[model samples]
Target: MILFFGTRPGKTVITQLPDTACPYCNQIGTLQVSKTSSYFHLFWIKLFKITTDTIAECSHCKRVYYENEFTEAMRKELP
Candidate 1:
């Protein structure tokens, strides 16, 4: 799935992902795949597989959101 790993303005660089516990998966690796940041106008999107970034598919919910997104939310929630 394509994830926003912090932007450089115009690019939406996407890394790849797989269906396993990220820590246990290890079946994937880093490969850079990107898109136009303009597309982010959609609040949520089904990211394109570019490379893995510690992201794993939930066996139950099967919902995918960036781990970074969750972390950022928690950081904001803390304050």
Candidate 2:
């Protein structure tokens, strides 16, 4: 018998951060937050979520900010 199991990334949820500016670009209202969840799968079937990652991107300058790079203003906008 053979088994196929691995981890896969789930759908991404995007939300706009109102009254927030990009930390790198300093552009207001151009910051969008994306949340992605990883899940364990067995034979192409999702079993359970492994972890969730949060990131912020600037539409103007296209800067990506990871969880550890978030600023005080960025943290407050997350749900």
The lDDT of each candidate is 0.35, 0.92
Kindly give the number of clashing pairs for every candidate.
6, 0
Question: What TM-score do all the candidates reach, one by one?
Answer: 0.21, 0.88
Global Cα lDDT for candidate 2 = 0.92
Candidate closest to the true structure, highest lDDT: 2
Tens-digit per-residue lDDT, 1-79, candidate 1: 7644421234444544332222332333322223333322223553343433333243344444444633332233221
Cα lDDT tens digits, model 2, 8-70, are: 999999999978988777889998899999999999999999999998889999999999999
TM-score between model 1 and native: 0.21
Deviating ranges (above 4 Å) for candidate 2: none
Clashing pairs in 1: 2-47, 2-48, 15-51, 16-50, 16-51, 16-52
Q: What is the lDDT of residue 79 in candidate 2?
A: 84
